[model samples]
Target: MALPVLVLAVRWVMMIMGSDPRAVGLSAEPIDYTINYLGLWAIRFLILSLAITPLRTWARWSWLAPLRRPLGLWAFACALLHLSVYFLLDQLGSFSLLWESVAKHPFILLGMAAFTLLLPLALTSTRGAIRRIGARRWQALHRLVYLAAIFTAIHFILRVKGFQPEPWIYAGVAAVLLLVRALPTAWVRRA
Candidate 1:
């Protein structure tokens, strides 16, 4: 919602400022920072979307169910932005460089895999799509989100250099979220 808009606004402002001394402390390359920021937000929203079902079931918060679609869409949007930043700003429209980076970096492949999985889920998110595809089939297809989330967490972990806690924390959160989803319905109900 407003969060994505604000982030985009700030990015726009930074671009206009053009090598302002104040931004030096943020990162050597502002585009790189923005790409990472977008990717992180994508992961956060994806995790939040997965949490909706567990929260609704355990906490009896039925209203949270509807929020899942919007959250998931937002995650996809952020991921799209992340990819755009890397392809456009980082690679500068050079297909050779893009291919070189993808071939050299396994994390880029993981991120691409995650984004590929998300694409179909985002496409079939609408009510009309659900009706056309049938609810059961749609649900089965959307289960790919869990796999996408795993790939995304791995991508984040692999992308970072050295020993960073942030990626590990994201991985831990994703694991817990997946565990909640994996639990039996009866077990969840008993809790």
Candidate 2:
């Protein structure tokens, strides 16, 4: 599960360090490439995490629920990497630039909001943390991933130059996954 995340992180590191400045499937600019690549992946993992429970029910695969933890953590890592690249490379480690971006760009604010929401979820995604927090409270807290995904979707769409179907497709997937959760259990189980 972590293998893909590890490889992607390494590749991003290499890109940032000039070892591989060309982004294969993303923007030509390294900073934009890193930021966009990581941002999209962050949202992907987040939506995948959100899909676990619903998939478990729909498929009658109880084992699927355990997959959410690692996916959520990966999503959190991607989000952290995305923000780190922007702050470190794009902002040149300047707080003033970060603040300026936040002020001037609503997309940046949305991205920050999504990251803020995922922080606690990732931090507490462990058996020990679950035990300490109590199962019920922990479940409630982790539900923030859904909101995080929404914010990420919005951030992704807004960060681009104009309306594009790709970001909209992501948003659509997030919405469908969320809708699945709101569905009646009996109805979902029948599907």
Q: State which candidate has the highest TM-score.
A: 1
Tens-place lDDT per residue, model 1, 108-127, is 88998899999999999999
lDDT of 2 at 20: 42
- Model 1 misplaced regions, further than 4 Å: 17-28
TM-score of each: 0.91, 0.88
- Count of backbone clashes for each model? 0, 0
Report how far off residue 21 is in candidate 1 (Å).
Answer: 7.1
lDDT of 2 by residue, 55-165 (tens): 888887788877888888888988898899889989999999999988888888989989999989878988999999999999899888888888899998887776679
lDDT of 2 at 177: 93
When summed lDDT is taken over every stretch of 10 residues in candidate 1, the lowest stretch is 19-28
* Cα lDDT for residue 167, candidate 1: 92
